[model samples]
Target: MAKTLLRSVGLFGAGMIAATLAPAIGAVDVGTYKELDQFMSVFERVRADYVDKVDDRTLIKGAIDGMLASLDPHSAYLDARDRQNMRTQTQGSYGGLGLSVTMEDGAVKIMTSQEDTPAAKAGLKTGDYITHLDGKLLYGGSLDEAVDQMRGKPGTRISLTVVRPGRDKPFDVSLTREVIQLKPVKWEVKNEVGIININTFVNSNTGDSVRAAIAGVQKSLGHDPLGYVIDLRSNPGGLLDQAIDVADIFLDRGEIVSQRGREKGDIERRYATATPTDLAHGLPIIVLVDAGSASAAEIVAGALQDQKRALVMGERSFGKGSVQTVLELSDDTALKLTTARYYTPSGRSVQEGGIKPDIIVPQLSDADYKARPRLREADLRRHLINEAKVDDKILEDDGKPDPRFQLTADGLKKQGIDDFQLDYAIKTIARMSQPPLRTALAGAKRGAK
Candidate 1:
């Protein structure tokens, strides 16, 4: 019988595995060897006696995936396709809908859709679910597979069945794919204030772009702007080095961020470059964040807040403080491992408890902002624990209705304010730039008297 043969092979393979590993490890721990032996037994049994033939590569890849999946949600084995996708994303151009997504309960959930992308244009909001692609069910499939199906030749059309919370029934959205060219940093002058929107940190030229944005703002005004608003809302993070560079641009001195590995002494610290010129020239800055701001985005926000260089505004960020190091295993394969937990300059990790804003400015312009459920690092399966043990009570109470955020979407629209958060930030900057009315009128009053 197949069962009898499988049992015999499993016992034989266990002994063989112990004998093979003993010589290499030199007195292998009994417990570890037993576990490895059990693994080998299953592997051998599957290879020799499975109902249908299975390739070694498939089996090995599955094992590697299983191993990484046990560690954390972020760690994974990147195949050739995955590696290519990673490179494309970092380079800032890809053929897709330009959506940041995550797998939750075997369904692909939308994290955030990039501005001006097909997904964003299609009215796909954050926290929406893609239940089907092109009328085919996508649930119960791998995230990678769903992503691959979504990405194709530019101008290709794809239909998505979206299941959004608060909606009674699912809706279909038809989108034509295009090259999603991510502008890492976008700048504009509003009310004589420099508005620097950092959409992503994945691009290599993100730091340079920020510098250029400041220069552009100055050129437009023919003078230094009142202040700057660094908008980092819905910014999923990218490169660590890029984050350090961007933070250094504004900071003259002090630590930017520090990452700690497994060992106590295995720590690396990054500091801002000592420069004579402050890019903003000590101007009042407001770093705006929301639930969608993450990783490198948090790095920039955290550094500015900790150094007292900028007032962090808006909602708390997406707390993904762990650092991932990609180790290439082969020409086409690599291991993306969670190597360290990064801390802000003040030695606070934004793991589950993200960077709390000095001014909690909610996005009142969004009608569904209150009704929609937010997904964060704490919501992920097998997420790394914050050593400080984040207070659940604080997290639960964060969304409690504040009397300060009184503006509603319809009310804001009536006032011609489309983006409440950005408008609030710009207004704050404008107020900081002007001198006190009492001081300005003091001379006039004295002369009149």
Candidate 2:
């Protein structure tokens, strides 16, 4: 069986950085030889006439990099350093600012910052552009270069010139690098409700961590709590098998997710176990997702939502639905190639459109929520297109304001509610526990706004 996993830079990776081990291909046709001949022609010219002295290894590596870059943004050629970075991240420990970043038009754009890390502590939000590193311009630099610069000996300080969307001008944020030891799952009981925070799916044991969290919640409360709130905000995905495992924990039956390759007959579907594996025991559950929840996170959310096991709340997801298979070209090199497009159990492809939440719960805690623009799979250059047409009207509808969400950050703070989305989700579950209080509380909460 192939070992399928996803990774980006740090905890919450940027774009879709996942891979599966594949055997080397040996077939080559005459038409390919002609293309190789053309490539060799350019290679010879660069080697002979270039002003700077170039080595064969460097030229070949550059050619490979250019070849992969021509494809979708998710595909890339991973060198030794990149492979080591991927391994360290999936293992749940690394030294860096703990930010998941990607290249956009030669500038490095932040995907999301991992919780409790140096980047998150420094208040770097998604969609912020890193224009300079240590007062040196980083524009037109490769993502690999940026990542290599950011990740280094722990405790070393670095300054970043950030260009935020709503800010009047660029600002410098100084941060010290630290080892990011990821705790994939964290559970706590709030108002007799279980809140499970899944930070990332990069860990192979993430599914097991979630299972432990469920058991811990029950043990901590002396019984099964009212329900669970699976918080997947800013969680850029990880292992494919762990996604199936996590989704399987909630679903007793039915398909969880499916991946389809280029060939018409090449399709694989993952289903939940028939056993009574629903740990919550049919309790009311809610899945919270934001624009940063992607790939494996979307898989779990899509499975639970389609199976009617949980009510998905919050804003739309990051919408990265493709799978990358890492083919080892050499001992120290691999090709991360996008080979398939995954779909939800209900046959919905969340490529550019993402997983639309059943309830659109905006984050009222952030004062700059409305000013900051969101970055998703659709926004990337050379992204894979979803064959099924997406309704633009439906996509545009998510931006509209709701009367129930009229509260400002100050208003929420005064009410002692720092996170309005989480507070609302917990209150919603509390209402479900008491059916009689639903109408009265709903009216009061909505009318008060």
Write one digit per residue (lDDT tens) for candidate 1, span 1-449: 00000001123466666787578768867787679877887988898999999987788789889999999888888888887887887775778898988888999999999988999888788899999999999879998899989988889999999999987999999999999887898899988899999998888899999999999999999999889999999998888989999999998888999999999999999998887456998777899999899999999999988887788999888889999888776777778888899999999999998998988887899888888877788888899999999885685476667786898999999999989999999988877666783344334434532
Q: Could you estimate the TM-score for every candidate?
A: 0.90, 0.90
What stretches of model 1 exceed 4 Å from their correct place? 1-28, 396-401, 436-449
What C-alpha lDDT do the candidate models reach, one value each? 0.86, 0.86
- Model 1 accuracy (lDDT, Cα): 0.86
After superposing candidate 2 on the true structure, give the runs of residues whose Cα lies further than 4 Å from its correct spot: 6-31, 435-449
- Candidate 2 whole-model C-alpha lDDT, 0 to 1: 0.86
Rate residue 148 of model 1 by lDDT: 88
Task: Report the number of clashing residue pairs per model.
Answer: 0, 1
The total number of steric clashes, by the backbone 3 Å criterion, in model 2 comes to: 1
